[model samples]
Target: MTKTIIFDFGNVFINLDIEGAIKHTFNSFKIDALSEEMTAFNSFYEQGLISTKEFIEFYVENFPNISKEEIIDIWNFMLKDFPKHRLEFLKQLKATSKYKLILLSNTNELHIDSIKKTIPFYDEFKNYFDAFYLSHEINLRKPNKDIFDFVLTENKLIANECLFIDDNEDNCKTSKFLGIKTWHINPKTEDITNLFKLKSELFN
Candidate 1:
């Protein structure tokens, strides 16, 4: 019996354009691909091990030509829009009260700020959730196991009774390893416009 639904914010809720961001960064930096150090820095940033200032400074110092503002823009270009239909679907789900809803997103402050501006109803959507866990706020991230453990312990939820939904396969796999049921959502392949269709068993 699934009593809780854990949702991933990016892609699952709002669209993410990672490729576009990468292309924009490459054009700005005139680089073919990200350096090994940059990749490590990003991982640290995502894990909340490094502050946004530290992350930005590290890149600016390495790439002197790239302005801080430009870096911030490129970094935030990954975020797109939140469709009204998905918001309606979530609102309906919240009304059901059949399962506890939680949002677990691996995102930074800048991204969240950008999202709030783009989606004027961000707070209203957040209010619908039983818990909203942002990686930077919690100082933990997905695929680390610690974060999932924290959610499970904090919510007093049994892994078997929670279904985790994430766009990232690795995150879903980690949750599954912890005995939680998972739906590895592929935004390109699966349209969340009709989430109830995606998991009818829950409603049935």
Candidate 2:
């Protein structure tokens, strides 16, 4: 039986303008495409291999004209509203105590700080999770075997008894490969409030 439900943060709980953010970043940097080194630097930041100050410095050094605040704004452009209804859904789920709830997100300090500042119920949303694993804090990320292993091992969970829900197909594929069930949700057409209805077979 599935006793655990692991969720992804972006596009799952909070809405994100992913494509718009990418376009904004490119426009701000005046670059046609992200160079390999820049992409590697972002990955390092996400994995907590570099400090936020270091991450900002890299951008400042590369794009000398952009101010610090502008860089921050560009970096945070992807984040959108977290609908209150989702919080209501999570609260109801937590009250049930039917399954262990966990949040596994690939997020960084700046983005989180922004969310906490803007979202009033951020703490409440976090408290509902039995385990909250942020890639920057854990120094691990999704779509990787090691991170999944960490979650399963740390929680003493059986992969087959867990359901991971992520909007990214690659991340879902990785979890499925590890014997866990997954929902590769499409944010445009789906809402997490219908979790039980959409994956009724697993719950039953």
Best by lDDT: 2
Residue range with the least summed lDDT across 10 consecutive positions in model 2: 195-204
Worst 10 residues of 1 by lDDT: 195-204
Candidate 2 residue-wise lDDT, 73-147, digit = tens:
999999999999999999999999999999999999999999999999999999999999999999999898999
Top candidate (TM-score): 2
Clashing pairs in 1: none
The regions of model 2 sitting more than 4 angstroms off are none
Against the reference, the lDDT scores of all candidates come to: 0.88, 0.95
Residue-level lDDT of model 1, residues 1-204, one tens digit each, is 889999998998899998888899899889999899998888788767898899999989988988999888888998998887888889998998999999999998778878888899999989999999998888889888999999999999999999899989899989999999888888989866666677777533
Q: Candidate 2: lDDT of 65?
A: 100
